[model samples]
Target: MTLTCIAVDDEPLALGLVSAFIEKTPFLKLVGRYSSAVEALQGLLTQTVDVIFLDIQMPDLTGLELARVLERSNRGAHTTRIIFTTAFDQFALDGFRVDALDYLLKPFNYEEFLRAASKARQYFELVHRPEPAPFVISPAPPQPVEAADDYLFLKAEYQLVRVAHQDILYIEGLKDYVKVYRQSDPAKPLLSLTSLKVLEEKLPPKRFMRVHRSFIVALDQIDAVTRNSVQIGATTIPVSDQYKDAFGQFISRWL
Candidate 1:
């Protein structure tokens, strides 16, 4: 079982450091991160939040103030455990007043975090009812499937290649051949035997999107776009009419 958590801090470095810690701990999956108390408030209101790592010294709304507000709200009455994160030792009492699961000081070691995480796990197991936490699909507990894990180990001519999830930029179809643009080397795109549509199902929808019948692009790598074409380095690929709706939502957010 995984403990879905979100980290909130006014500082970007603090957010990144906490995110790195969460990544190292596989049981804790990061749902989101916020740089302000206001933004965090909005997310909690809509998203089915389980754990929150809140910093106490934010600008507009102090962490204590935010905690006070959440504690009173009817939504917060449900089983969400908050782990207050802060730099000051003086405010430990304030955190306990709000029923914080654990208090973590900044610049904490992995072992310290693990201890805090263990406490969170205990609280979660004790409180949360046996029900799927809300998401669009409410995906069944991430199970391992051999078909889903399959990735081609390609060798073009003499050079050996290890094609993994992160190595791929996008896929392009040309008749029977599909080209996988290398993420590391943008200048080169590898030709492969796999069908573009078949490989599309293997990749996560959040990371990859079908922009055209003959093309799919990595959402992370897309830098610039026009109405018809999206730029990945020097290459400009067309956005077909078939995937216009999804492409439009992606564009509206980024643009």
Candidate 2:
């Protein structure tokens, strides 16, 4: 799972360094970078980020102050993790007081940055990991002489769209939205304001499987299944550890 993150620092060099480091890290997707805490705070209000690489010392709104505000704004379970980056080591205690995950002493190497990032990644993975749904077998119901209607009506672009179940190649999950990709026109995807979990329940379990946290692929649309990924058309989706066991059982049937 990729973690969406933003960097906030008053110094140009510090901001650029964190931005570059985030770019280099595969799991970290840079959503936005700012040179001031005010701008970063505004961006946070608009975007759903998983982590923040913030510099503790800034004019007007220090990272500590911003963290306090964020703590108040986003209380309870879905709070964003913070990693303070500062030249002074004295602020380390203050960083922990605000529940910062990790801190980086400026002029640190890439390895050190990666270690801190890894800690944040582990924390998120533990907290936000998907639990495996209980699988059970039920007695088959009486068959209908005529096949039941196999289509879903989804609301998109202010219109109710009828989509055939078999036409879907895969579904990608954005923060609060899901993009349904169809085999008919791979170029266009129908965007709906729904969660992946909701679609997972709507789709026939026999036809689709959740291979990754962000992806649910059509079993018949899968052209290949590698040791770590599944190929549908030109796209290769990773099979995360959380769903690997279920996928393995599915593959065992035909293997």
Candidate 3:
């Protein structure tokens, strides 16, 4: 199966090189090329590709930041994976943290790029492999009912911990789990086996606002607001372009 892909880099030369590499790969199909992470994010809203050849460092939004957004949003059910291409070797850990398939350091040759592309192709094949039909099909489970506005229960460390809405400072999304930061406990956060999107649906929208794809901040706990980020206590959470207008309106209310 040919994998549809896109190349994103701020530098024209790097973008062109990656695009050319995609074209030469027999198993890969190049769909789009973006100069900035912001442009890539916008393009992704309408375009669905199998993989992304992403650059880690960019002006408005870094590749790591964009990967977090895609992970949280699940790219609207497309499940597009990332293969980071950058000059910085330091971002390798950060790239993997967001589940990047591979990290290609700058000045990489077509052979290196092909190896990464081959790995991606294998992954997609495994994911798309067909399973034998089961004779005894089980019924689907019911969805969880929304909790009360005052509090919610989250399963953490094998126990259902009761968390009050008023005590929460912010929620951070990490892949499939979330770290719920509380006002009472500043240093330690409760880790729950749930997505930020799941928690967002349960929380009262007026009391909490999702400022970033990876973060949902308590509206009342915001201490300060900057051009692209919000300060909650000593921690700063970014407000990405997708949610910037809503967050700006929230800021305008108090000003």
The best candidate by lDDT is 3
Estimate, for each residue in 1-255, the C-alpha lDDT of model 2 and write its tens digit. 899999999899889999999999999999999998999988987878888999988998999999999988844567698989999999976776677888899998899999988878877776677986764556887455433447776645423467898899999999877899998989999987678999899888889999888999999999888768999989989999999999999888768
Question: lDDT tens digits, residues 121-193, model 1?
Answer: 7666645548754545445776544553435554332122457766777788887557888877757778654
Assess candidate 3 and give its lDDT. 0.89
Estimate, for each residue in 107-160, the C-alpha lDDT of model 3 and write its tens digit. Answer: 999998988898788778866879856545449765665445799877563334
Question: Backbone clash tally for model 3?
Answer: 0
Candidate numbers, best TM-score first, in rank order: 3, 2, 1
Per-residue lDDT, model 1, residue 53, is: 82
The TM-scores, one per candidate, come to 0.49, 0.52, 0.53
Predicted candidate 2, C-alpha RMSD: 16.4
Which residue runs does candidate 2 get wrong by more than 4 Å? 75-77, 132-255
lDDT of candidates 1 onward, in order? 0.77, 0.86, 0.89
Indicate the residue-level lDDT of 151 in model 2: 75
